[model samples]
Target: MTLLRDLPLSALRALAAAARTGSLTRAADELGVTPGAVGHQLRQLEDRLGVKLVSREGNGIALTRIAEAALPDIDRGFDALASGLRRLRFERRADTFTIAADPSFSSLWLAPRLDRVRAALGRLDVRIVLSIALDSMLEEGIDLAISYRKSSARDLASADLFTERVIPACAPALIGSRSDRDGAGMLDRLPLLHIDQTMGDDVYPTWGNWFTAAGGQRKNIDHGSRFPLTVLAAQAAISGMGALLASELVLREHFRSGQLIEIAREVPALTIRRRLVWPVDGPKARHAAAVAAALAATAIAEADGPWPTKS
Candidate 1:
């Protein structure tokens, strides 16, 4: 190991390839070099190590027991080096355009409008991540984030995109019918689909909260099955399982497509301000800011809702 510090790696690489393939010709073919060049490198390596580790047998070469034993580790070292280079290359590409986003918003909201975003940004390599909250934006080498958490760090800049505006929406079929022409009141034994954000950074409203907000009283707030994400709950509601107090921000498509109808106009739910966050004066800051503006404009264009306007 100590002798290898100053030695040129090309010779060692030739030895490994020759030993692996059992022939200098095959090694040279793998390395895109002549058999003579491979033999010469092997000679140089043996001279540097001060040992006859390779025995020439025509086009084939045989290694000593110790050198043969070392081949596996040497191969592993080369593999690790190659992996490191690949990681560096990926980091370079990822740093150009990477975005972290809340799972619900990313899956339900932003995913559908990605075409619009791509069209607006134009000539982009975008990566929108739906993952957990990190200790820092730079930890994952993220250029930006569309998150429920606002940035207050000195190194980061954020713009308030929208406030959480949850509303009760359910399948069109679930509402009142038969003799009750209008969907005015709650159905008999209406199954409430609860959102379980127990591990999340923010707490969302329960069925109890919405009922209270609507100036009514309801029991068994914890009756229904709970889902971790609003998008999942919305899907359940869309499937006619029950009503979901969903956010209008992400469920705009469902509401528009008539898969889900508003059981109520709006309800006071667990409110959290979502922000477009990025490193202040970063290499991608300009791009991030441009992305934020494009997204906001897109959201505004979709419908008149909760996006804040310039004063």
Candidate 2:
């Protein structure tokens, strides 16, 4: 309630730590200070507030009723201050990278390659935000965005990572029940689960598009069920809700495992390329390049076949 500038922040922090841990020594250890230093701060804080903050016993300390009541508010204030400082420090760190990506790309592609990234770049801190909002990356805070794009945008310094390719997918049970061997022909009988883009910023790659690309017709294009994300649509397919036009990058392992059947591998290619994009002249550009290289290499290796097979 008082003016923040008038409060002794360091002493309040020490009081909060001591109240939380119930011991000056433990709190001191956490703060990287000596027990005596912690005690001095606590004493200073109590003197400033004109209250006995802690009751000292044999080896431990207990907060007084007044201390207990005031500590929650004090701790909350300290926590908010600490969080702000952390964000400031993170923003200042030149090596720390933040990436904005689609949910499917984050889960299917980048997440699998994180180990390779860690091994290549020692202890690099990456903050991955699930988004297709390119505007967020152009803002001050976001460093880069790895996204599925049909072409490069003028605002972004972009490099191609990999193409977004789709294959017909359904649960193993659904595939087994079908009489046809070719996946494309089965679309007429089965419902096609659609993944509608929630933001309307990204276009949904559909079975009809793939079918037409592969020299088939969209006469049997089914739009029985819809989901917001490809991952959710794939899950619905896996549960036998309907067939899904899913990315090969995402469905590779599932297809090999027999969890989901690839209705047709030779279907038309509705491929979209992934791009590592950032503001043309920003500090994040180099970091985005490094990440793009690492991610591209991973995607290439995975796309080589010998994918995860049914055990």
Highest TM-score among the candidates is held by which one? 2
lDDT of each: 0.72, 0.72
Error of 1 at 64 (Å): 29
Distance from true location, Cα of 253 in model 2, Å: 1.7
Model 1 TM-score? Answer: 0.59
| lDDT (10s digit) by residue, model 1, range 175-236 | 66433312324632578898776322454566676777667766676788788877788889
Lowest lDDT block of 10, candidate 2 = 197-206
lDDT (Cα, 0-100) at 252 in candidate 1? 73
Lowest-scoring 10 consecutive residues by lDDT in candidate 1?
179-188
Q: After superposition, how far is residue 62 of candidate 1 from its true place, in Å?
A: 40
- TM-score for all predictions? 0.59, 0.62
Global Cα RMSD, each model: 11.9, 12.2
